[model samples]
Target chain A: MITMIELAESIYEVIKDYRNHDNIFITPENIIEWAKQFEDNGQLVLTELNKIIKETYISRVRAKEFIYEHILSYLKLYEYSSIAQFLIDTEFIDVQQIHKSQPAILQLLEEVLTEKFQVSYLPYKGFPKVNYIYFDDILASGSTIGRDLVIFLNKKNSSGQKFYQLIQSNEIKLSISVFCLHTWGFEFQKYRIQKEFNDKVLKKINWFWNYEIQNHAKFNNQKLNIAKPVKGSSSKINSYLENLSATKYEDYAYRKANTPTTEHFFTSAENRIRFENVLTEKGIDIINMIKGEAKSNIRPLGLINPQYKIFGLGTHFFTWRNIPNNSPLVYWWEVAGHNWKPLFPVANRGN
Target chain B: MKPSIRTYQIKDVVTFAKTNGEFGALSNMAAGFNLFINEVNIQSSEILYQACRFPLFPHIQEEIVRTQNPMDAKKVSRKYMQYSRQDWYSIKFKIMKWCLEVKLVQNFDNFSQILLATENKVIVEYSTKDAVWGAIPQDDKTMLVGQNALGRLLMELRERVKANVINKSTIIFPPNIPAFLLFGCPIEEVRNDDYFIVDLDEIYA
Candidate 1:
């Protein structure tokens, strides 16, 4: 009958000789010995074997860990003064801090507007005079944010014009300031202007308000009609907007216990210790045992209806021309029911 | 021992011809006869027994009936006239040679055994399960093609067996037949009931 030892041997050969890497050598014989030791120490089931392999080999590193160790260090030396200063001085800024920071920035902008030009704070009764838009870090693939920004800008610009007409006779300019200007914002602004005035403009609009459009020709000629139907469009958009609105002013706690680098180092060390402990308890040198098992030839279990007929014993012998006499005799023997066990030379020694 | 002669139907003749690669030649030779294997002559004597169904040439049926006595070899040969004697004999020789070569026949006590032996050496009849030609009747032209294919296959098997290419038998069953005809070798009916039986002893003897 096929035993756990055989399975362990096969698995060990597969894993050890994987990709022919010289550094990673785990033989079948050694693995079998290790498994026997584990069984002797009271670990019996194959599920336990799977657990041991997972604990020993599979490395665990979360997405958040990647973000902290690799992403944060590069972000520290950002050219933007305010964002860098904020991260350095406060250690971290949560959503609430973002809300607080926005108002202070706006207050500074208001002061600048007042001192620099004739400005009026015309608070529209129906819509709030001050509007804020929040986004996560690095807004490329502007498809999502572009749509939101366009709607907001269009509403604010239209309302700002109406407010100017109501409050002042002279043209009053409007300004937009975001926490960080993404590298591709200029392309998005150009795209918006070209889309809005697609048919009306004789030549493509080269500039949008004061933002100098980079890749203006590319944006102008772009065929930005909805390429394909978005999946679950109505529900997905509604839920995303709802979540953004709910968490607009919420505060998230920031605690740096250990960066992922140190955490991963500790994790590797812990895994090594656990492996060593298990090996010591079992009293098996795993690598050597697997090698030994691989070299041993196991006997095959025999066929169900054994067909053995000896004809013309002393006469002319006839054998198939194709099959060589020296070739290994491999046979499958039925063990219990439908299952068949393959016995190798070692197992078939007496037979 | 009485040598029994059995008459075969057109379908059976076609099948034998196909398996032996003589269908085309046989069909051409047997044209206008309306039947095949007319007056089965054993040794030099024509067997005259109404109990056994006999194939008769359409033109000589009246002559055969009036004679009442078994015709001489010359007379029987004349009555069972083939369109082309040379072509007919050549095709017959080729088919008979092929049958001998493939060991489709096994001799028991000097008689050619029509039924092949199973793995246990038990005589297996040429039923729908074992007989390659026992199936539905095909047109004369198609029968010719089938005969030719069977003949070629038999020759190949003969060479392999002789050389001992493999100890085991390597006969391939015919494929691509209508479901109804898929079961067995085609057989000719005599008197609409009597079926042809392979006589193993006579051929070997």
Candidate 2:
């Protein structure tokens, strides 16, 4: 059999080409070492993980293509289209100071705008006005974007109508563009808007996304296309679930017992079971090693609702910049005291 | 006597209620039969049906959807009676039938399996208070009487399933009535196996 380091060799080739992978100081050696954490299963896990990275790792080159493609699709604007006035009129939202991803995403958007359109427009830099367009990398629980948009919409302009009221009156429109979106996250965002503003304002907003995560994680869904575990009937999973704090999300604590009627996310049905089980079991072991109360949002698999009593959102999505905290912890949990090393140590986050 | 009672009375019947009985999957209140529509994860068809009552008030729809139980969804509807659409009474049957169809499409395996189990028998919703969507026992358990709107819809659904004629796309196209909405968003067409959404500007205006 190949050595553990050799097992990670192939992924190193892929990782080297992963564009925009800056500043976290990862190397091929780190990849090999990260795989060794799985010991005997190291080779198998790394191979499956390599497949995902190849499929999902959005190099800067690819992200630019995606950004340009989607922007054109949204604007119906082109290289020849009149964009000077439209650029000045759009306010790409920069409200998420609670996390680092939104700022980073805006920065990337700025670069793309300069390259693709030759507009000196810097995203998240100009005053809020005109047709509002919010840009973010991904939306998980929707708290950050929801809270941010709420603040922006409640603000009053010189005319004294609230931004939401302005939107309802058709003085301007709002659009959201993201690399990835979760169905639940979008719903939660809508719920936030409905509670704070009204649907009339919501109707003025549009959404554009490249990758859609279909893990609504509702109960009794037999075919899940996201990273959820095999059922928690297993002794370890059941015990972990039973011990969770009471939460309304307990209904989503497991993927349906019969799952992945189609394995759209993973390599295959058999491999999905293999990869998810290993990742979940490893995640639990990592959680056990936590020194104390691992924040309310932390879970065995990844991040979820603070009150959500499930394994996690099982987000398997990734980008060249960073893995979302909503992904399985085995991908991004880098606590200093923990025994396991994350495959992708997140950059620029307080975590 | 109600003139409609005889027209709706059934002798050979398969009844559903109590949510856990043999034919309970036919009840809108049954658990494990959820639906994803217009990007919202609806708790039950009852919640979806109640939500259809207030298309203009998204807040009411959210209140009903966030309720933990279906019975409470109805209570939530009654709580905001004034906000209900003016044309609700006239359009409710069309909306409820559409909600059931959505339940079948989204929860195809469990819903269709149970629906096919009824085979050729007349399906009835056993109810104590609601005689319109369901039926009331008139003579012992033998005679079930009332408008039986829900039962009639189910029988129609059963026949459609038997003949394999569901459009696979009507959940988003709900019988061409005005103001059929969830969360105030007009569902246009099924985007994929996942969601139903339309372009915003054309309909939002």
Candidate 3:
């Protein structure tokens, strides 16, 4: 006998008091527990209401707020400014505050440069560029420092291209100097090699080519003997570098190689096992064994065996005899411009 | 469109009798009468007299026949006559009240058109003047007759309508009531025993 209007009013009254309660923003476990209590009390409507409220509150509270606001700013002031100042004084570099930081690294660099050598703050229209690019600390991933460098480089090149192009054309020599605030060991080496190789390869191919090699050696620094297959032990250690799909293999082998620990290694391994199991279950005759030998303590090109020769990195063992009726690999080969293997002729038959 | 008696009416009553016919003589009599009257014209004086004269009928009629002078013939006749009128009036009032409560009677005329009963299946005649309007098959044997004999005439009316025997007349009820109230018999004597019938169009329209 209750009217729809009265039911709507009762629902509003139940929800109004708990609208902005801080307990609603408690952890997911606590929220779930509260929901269970509500359900037990025969309050199904209240349980759903509380779940929606808690989820909204949690989503509004952004993750990692302290790191963005506090830690990053402190690093820019004390560490980056001192490193920038050293770079300016040691070299006769013109340092300017195109972007500002707290306790101002660019300002400190400008002061040190004016005291040691000739320095001037360049306006947007008129700018002079000699050499040297500097940064504070380098991590395993070069993305952060690389992004900042690109922004500064773009600003320097905005006017006439005289500053950057003249330096690039070799009329004036441009040398990039990054003062190491801490040991940037492996990442620095990889970045330098990638830049040099990228420039050389671009000229020859008339296209930019970049690669990151994932060193699986970091997983277990000790060399793995591929000849021995240990029984009753985890095959995970052996095929740890094996199960990567073509795209994943390329990404891990190239870009993510520099920081393999940061990559979800376990998840990637599980995915590889799952993919291999699916292929095997489908009765694919392709090789399941990881190909190639581990050499010089590095799992090189031949170290891991692939079911298919992806990016032309490994050797093909057996081409499926039933070519036309073969699995999706045959279809892929046709799309990739490889000629279809002919059906066996009668002449090739033996008595 | 003309209405027809539901084919399930006999079966529904039979089933109701088998399930709920436990409460004593009146319930047994009502059930037996329902089965009997459905097949014969009880409105005819000859048939009603014969029916009332049955060995069991005397027991039931004795309950209705109240008299001060059993020896005086004229007084006994008047008393029996008055008893008949009172019984007929009570039955008519009870049926009318049931039709009203079930929302089958639309007006006073609708109430008059409805033929409801505890001991006979109910019927409603939408029109009074149409030819074949009062004609109905009282049983597998004889067809019903008479305009004032409400129960017999209403069944005949329904049969005529169903056979396309009457074009303009509408007959309602193999006693359609709301599904929830099918078990809710209001009459205390009949509550646990007999089935009641109402003509929906008579009240609802």
Top DockQ model: 2
Candidate 2 Cα lDDT to native: 0.70
lDDT values for all models: 0.25, 0.70, 0.26
* Candidate 2 chain A minimal-lDDT segment of 10 residues: A217-226
State fnat for each of the candidate structures. Answer: 0.00, 0.07, 0.00
lDDT for each residue of candidate 2 in A1-351, tens digit (9 for 90 to 100): 555566577666666544335545567788878777877767777767766766656666667777776667656732325566667667766776645766767676677878888875664347555677788878776666776788888888887888888888878777878877877768757644653565456656788888777676431232355666767446787787778884544656777655544565666777777777777888889888888776666777787665567788777677777777778888887778678788786775654
Ranking by DockQ: 2, 1, 3
TM-score, every prediction: 0.15, 0.64, 0.19
Where model 3 places Cα greater than 4 Å from the true spot, the runs are A1-127, A151-159, A162-164, A171-351, B1-205
How would you encode candidate 1's per-residue C-alpha lDDT over A1-351 as one tens digit per residue?
A: 346666665445324432232243445554554455344432232223333332222111211232232223323433324422322322111122332233333343334334433342223223422212232222222333344434433442444554223212323222222222222233333333323322112021111111111111111121111001111233432232233322210110001112111322112333323332332222112212333341111111010011111000000000111111111111112123422221111111112
lDDT for residue A237 in candidate 3, whole number 0-100: 31
| Top lDDT prediction, candidate number | 2
Best by TM-score: 2
* Backbone clashes in model 2, listed as residue pairs: none
Docking class of 1: incorrect
Off by over 4 Å in 2: A1-7, A17-22, A77-80, A122-128, A219-223, B1-47, B50-205
CA error at residue B61 for candidate 3, angstroms = 99
